[model samples]
Target chain A: MVTNEQRLACAYLLKVGEPPAPALRSFVSEHGVVAAAEAVRSGEVPDSVATETSARRHIDTAAEDLAAAKSVGARLVTPEDEDWPAWPLLPLTNAAARGLKWASPPLGLWVRGSASLEESLQRAVSVVGARAATSYGEHVAAEMGYGLASRGMTVVSGAAYGIDGAAHKGALNANGRTAAVLACGIDRAYPAGHSTLIDRIAAQGLVLTEYPPGTPPARHRFLVRNRIIAALGAGTVVVEAGQRSGARNTAASAAALGRVLMVVPGPVTSAMSMGCHDLLREGLATSVSSVAEIIESVGLFGEDLVTKPDSAARPTDGLDSEALRVHEALEPRVAHAAERIAEASGVPLSRVRALLPALELTGLAERCESGWRRAKEPV
Target chain B: MVTNEQRLACAYLLKVGEPPAPALRSFVSEHGVVAAAEAVRSGEVPDSVATETSARRHIDTAAEDLAAAKSVGARLVTPEDEDWPAWPLLPLTNAAARGLKWASPPLGLWVRGSASLEESLQRAVSVVGARAATSYGEHVAAEMGYGLASRGMTVVSGAAYGIDGAAHKGALNANGRTAAVLACGIDRAYPAGHSTLIDRIAAQGLVLTEYPPGTPPARHRFLVRNRIIAALGAGTVVVEAGQRSGARNTAASAAALGRVLMVVPGPVTSAMSMGCHDLLREGLATSVSSVAEIIESVGLFGEDLVTKPDSAARPTDGLDSEALRVHEALEPRVAHAAERIAEASGVPLSRVRALLPALELTGLAERCESGWRRAKEPV
Candidate 1:
């Protein structure tokens, strides 16, 4: 349970403090919120600490803002909250990913809507791409989103226009659970045109953010928020990204975190799909075109899905050099007796006869009344 | 050495013989075509050999066909000719490729065009694909073909419709050297519709086929001819192929022959590109979108070509755990003193200060009046 002091201190920190700061979190973690607050009030805090005039003045308002959150029917989920996600473990992964510089698990998240953040993220899949997506990209993204949602997986996205909007709509159209992780406050919609859609999402799904209420969306905030979406999902799918998409950052973070990274293939000609094609070519992500495929990739020991068969069935690859030499020696469209074949191939007659039937079995040779003719192609 | 007996004997063998046959070739090779024909006429040939009446009845016609070929301005290049393509050495690569059974070096080629068979193929790329290719596939094929030819590289292809025709036209449009390896006689146009195109290829480039003149195109002939396309070029690029395209056969042959195999990616939505996509996903072919990229892949000491710059320039990949944690601890858009970051991140103040400057050098963190904040995604 959060104490009155802990509540007030958290509220104060949330109101005026810049986040992810080591000093403030350490001070709060080491000492109870009450002690930290008292230290700030007495101007006796560590020299590294910044108890700015605005944060001091906002002390009284922290209580009121906490009440406002309740009034709005939203909950502030802290690290101590039972419902907190496991993404706080990212620091360990990011140590290897080197993504820690710009990517961090949120200190806390303010979530709204009836769905539980815990439940929503348990089996989540993120679908992200360019804001300027092509119809081909959008269509593929929507199908993937809908398919993933219909399979009982929560779909997560940033809720921007183009691919993001299409993904959200596809998930919603399937009447499936979805989550929108925003850079701005959960109380506001950054893309004004998406206000209604955001409301719909909040009504049926969940709206989550690390920013406090009234925080406006900023460029860096969005970059920071992308990690949240990636970390919350079981895997991240890049439906379509341009050469310089912010979605690429999300992919990197997921990859760094050892999260399953998948990509949808699009026309190589479309600029929107260039990032996807490049990722696939560079071997950074596996290619998946359908929900089943995506699930197969992220699913635990997913062996139910079948792989595409190799188009190559040439048994010609099985022939020994001597047999191949004899096979190659036999004429196309012309039959050759064993003696003739042996003479032409420089292999002995016994060896030529020994090789002919085996080559015939591999479909590289055919028997005719005159002798044996080479198949149109070797095995 | 145009011996009359050798000419008549070669004509007879060419007229009725199945190719790549060891015994007949050995008979011709060991004692010359004259001896082989004389043995056939005298019933002294190997027991496995067939001395049928029909071939003997056509004996008089053999000399006539040879005379006719000369009259029409064509040369029949035999294995004995110094101008045979290096493909005769395919057995060496095929030994490694395990392609001996279905693959063979051609016996001889009837050349109808003036271009040197050996020189034309020294530096060549084969662009071949489905006969029923989509407009997009054809478009890409044409561009690749034109680009390759414009770069002074010869383009080789089977002279079929769709991609093949487009490839030929693309080369011709650029007034570049091109070669068409046909299934039928060089004098016979199979598609009939491509008679003019075939003529243009023969006129501006070369028309070569392994089949003797007067032979007609057959289903198996096309299949057998595909290998020549693969062997004639330094590499083979599949512009588009359906799941069951014969182009896949050529790609397999190319792989078997150790030729560089490449594919031009198309929209995954199109079935015509499925084979190409599958090959790419299966790691069977490298993807190339333009002539420059194709050349880069096949060029000697190709690694000298510059690599594409990584979009993620964040030197975060270089930071250690302690530095990464401190870097991650610093808030985005907000700076903090070293002491503050140390406290929050659980590192000592001195260590935090030490890590900060290095992180700053890596462009993962930056110093500000407030202290330090993350650098906006490094260079």
Candidate 2:
């Protein structure tokens, strides 16, 4: 069990510094959570850490914030916890270490479900798209979510309107695990219309966010929140995104974090799919039309290889060019002499003589009273 | 001018050998057409050449064939003719020279239209697809055909129904040049239902084939004829196709001939687009969503580059992450002091004080009685 002291310190740090706070996170890693929290509160931290915490460090709402979270059945999941999802967020940590400031890992996640965040994320895919998505896009996104969740993978998404809501509902309908990474506080529903949907997600799977209690959802928070959604999933599927949507931002983050980025192709005439086509045209993402393709893309090497779709068989599928020519030369009702057939097919008389018997045996041609004719069906 | 003897020799050669007749084509290219024809007629040729011509070599119907063509207003265009599309057919000749037996150039072309074959094919794109195309496929094909033709490029297609017919009609409606390559005699319309459409194309553009007069269109001939469609254009666009459609055969032939292979994207739910999707997944063809993209794929270097699609602009498009957070922290109607805004936004008090004035200058925030509030719009 996590100590109450550590939990309180994490809660204090989480409330004081807005994530992703690279300077404060590193400070806590070096000086432990409790020491860092105390220093931040006393205004005794370094300039870098002070810059991130100075505005709210004096509030000292750790105990009240913890009570507020508990009132809503949420708890702080920190790195000290067993379900921190270290593996999935490693890419973000590494990217931040490489000086991508915006890719810093979140300080802690406030989760409102009983499922283990680490376990739920082990096989997860993020399904994201525009809030103004078309019906076609919504249908595809929901199908993708249901398919992925039914196969024992978690479907992660933002709990907003349009494609995200559709995906979450599809996952919930499958009785499968899903996690909504939100831009607002754990107790608040940003879109208001999706409050019931968000509540259902919290009861059935997980509703997670980095924001402290009572924080309202803001525009900039959505953009910042997208990185968490991208980090928590093994791969990201962009179903339908406009050229300038939040989903594109998540797609960029997924790519930067070295995750598999898959795009579903839609009709070229749709404005909603333009971003996806642009990514495909630029070779930045793979085109995945079916769930099998998605599995094959993100599954372990050679584990989920997709079987080629069956093509309709044709009667003359394996016929050589010359044999095909002879077959074409045969009339369905009229019998032509071997010499006439040879002349029409432009095959040598000897070759035609040899091929006719072979064709007759294969039931592609029939030896009529006069000479030969095409068989209407194989016998 | 092509001499009478050369035209007759080409006519006889076209009738005697079924293309692609590699040995006979090289023979005519080495010895003159007249000499090759005389040798084949007299049975005094090499075994390889004799193998290709032996069936019909003795039946010299050159004069009769010429008369039959004249009755239909068609004439034989030999390699010796001024209008032969030598430049456009160079790839086939080179492939045949490299010992690809299936890629031999045609002996001669039987032309039914007045346009110069070489001139009409100088800037061309072959638009091909399945005879069982969906309406969506037909619409895209027609749009591509009309768009390319309207830009002064010739549209080439087989005169079959569905996508091919739509493409040809689109080009014709634009009052632009187009060419219909046939599997049978130029005088014979293979898909009889399209006789009127074929006649319109011949009247407005060109109807040309490599087969002699009175020859019927056969299954093997359609496959054989596809090479010419792939060769006549600088690139080939597959609008829509089933897995086993002839359009895919043309796409493969275009790839083999080193022509640009482009595919139009359609809905994944549509079976008609599966072949195009497979090509895209396999990276065997480029995805072209617009006519401009098609031109960019085939046009001379940077000459027909496409402009990037414009995205809708947002007011906060240029704001830095911190500035955006500050903007998000300010409520539209409620004013709060700078200290409260700093705490809400988690920005340091000093930084918040500096950024608020900057936000005010940009009209993103306004000074209220208490402190500041978000401006409804930029002033």
Candidate 3:
């Protein structure tokens, strides 16, 4: 069980060090959160750990931070919590273990919603793109969000404007769950314009962040926060991103974390889709056209496979080349002798004679008093 | 030398059997054209060969066909001719040798153009698509044709409406060479709407086909004729295609003939681009957005390679995570001691002290008497 002491230690540690704090994370892992928090408070931790926490270690605000979180209806979910999303964050742990320092798992998450973090993220897919997205891109993103959500999959995004906001709204419109991983504190809406949308998401689904309360959203923090968005989702779809959009950073993080990476194709002329096309051209991402395709790409093996789309079959769909040529030779209005049909089709007389009966059986050709002619249907 | 008798014999063989006639091709390859034609006329050939030519063998229109071709400014370019495009058609021969009967090389091409058949196809790229293409598809196709033609490359396509007509027109607009491989006779234009376009292609470029004079365009012949279009070009670009459009057949033939297959990406909502997307999704074709990409895909080894596109670089593009955090913590108007900066950034005081000097050298930070502050530029 997670004791009050452990929760307090986790809340303190969450704010004491900047995220992706590899050395501090290692120390906490080795010493346990309660003991590690005590050591840091007493200035008795290792130099490497001190480097990560020294600046904030002197200020102990565990009790006040917990109170502030409670005031906003946000709870600190630690590794000791029952809903810590351990499985969804496994890739980050694995990647960090493989020596990617930036992929270190979060110390704790500050979440402002009632849904279980782990449960909400069980089948989540991240849909992200440029803030300057085109109308077409926004349309695709919204449709994909709605489709995936209606199919019982949670849509995850950063809760910013443009593509992200549209995706969140789409999920909400379907009355489906979605999680917004913000770059700012859970109590604060960084864009200001999305304050209501953030509230709706928190009420209906989740509004999560790794930043402590009172911590302002910084430029570098968004990049750091993207790792969480990428890790929480089973797959990442770049709906439409400019060549240097932050979504591309999320995509790269997703790929490095071993998450299924997908890209939606748009007009080659659209500058917003340049990053997506580059990813496809480099063979680093799969091309997904619809929600089903996205699911099929990231779903369990053989579980969510999409069927090959059916193309309308033509009347002469399965005819062999020779039979088709013979059928083409037959005239609809004028019935000609087998010799004339053979000459017109460039098929020998004997083969034409043999093929006529077969063609007639298929209702492609018919016999008249004059000779053989085409059926009413065109070739 | 291509003797008149040899030319006449090839003309008779060309009209005597439907193209892709494996048995007749083998007979002509083993026996000289003159002897093979004589044997076919006398009913002394093998049964297989007889099955291919028996119906038309009695017609004997060699002299009249030759006369008709000359009257329409067309010529019988036999295998014995110097400008037979042997290299361009080598893939058809190779594929046929590998047991692909439909890939049989043509015995003779009926040519109705002033350009040398062999020279015009030396560096050719086939740009083909649906007759019912969208405006966007047509625009891209025309641009590709114009770009390729202006670079001294021949743009090859069928003389149908939509993409084909746009491509041919684009090439002609540049006063560059192009070739039209028709399903019908060289003397006739299959789509009456494109008769003027066909005349222009013949006048300035080349109009070639294997079909004899007076042979009308049949549904099956378009498919049979696609093999030649696939062979004559080093690569084929599908600008746009419906799910079951004839362009898909051309794409298949191109792949079967071992030619580089490329498809232009379009909006997924477009039905005209469905076939191209399917090919891309199935990994059967490369996605090319520009003429440069197409050239890069089909160019010779170590030639015509495209460099990676340039993305705008940010000021902190190469900064490590720690440095970025430290930079973000620095204030623009106020300067504080390194300790304060270290605490805000969650970096060790010593590291912040070190990074400050380095950042100043890069003009990203400014040091005042009070401490360190951000430079005027945004992060």
lDDT of 2 at A133: 91
User: What DockQ was computed for model 1?
Assistant: 0.12
> Which candidate's DockQ is highest?
2
Model 3 C-alpha lDDT per residue in residues A1-379, reported as the tens digit of each score:
8999999899898888888788888888899999999999988988888878888898778888888888999999999888999999999889988999889999999999899888889989999998999998889889988998998889999998888988988999999999999887777896899999998999999998888888888888898999998998899999999888899999999999999999888888888988888788778788888888889888744677887677666667788877888999999899999999999998878889999999898788989999999999854
Better of 1 and 3 by TM-score: 3
Q: Would you estimate the TM-scores of all the predictions?
A: 0.74, 0.96, 0.96
For each candidate in the order shown, give its overall lDDT on alpha carbons: 0.73, 0.89, 0.89
Q: What digit string (tens of lDDT, one per residue) describes model 3 on residues B184-302?
A: 98878879989999999999899999999888999988988999988888999999999888899999999999999998888877889888988887888888888888888898435
Query: Could you give candidate 1's per-residue lDDT for residues A72-188 as a string of tens digits?
Result: 667777666667675534542354245354453455677888887776788889899999999988888788778888888888999898888888888998999888988877777
For model 1 chain A, the run of ten residues with the poorest summed lDDT: A51-60
Model 2 per-residue lDDT tens digits across residues A298-362: 87336778887777666777788888889989999999999999999999999999999999988
Q: Lowest lDDT 10-mer window, candidate 1 chain B?
A: B51-60
Error of 2 at B18 (Å): 0.9
Calculate the i-RMS of every candidate, to one decimal place.
10.4, 1.5, 1.5
Off by over 4 Å in 3: A301-303, B301-303
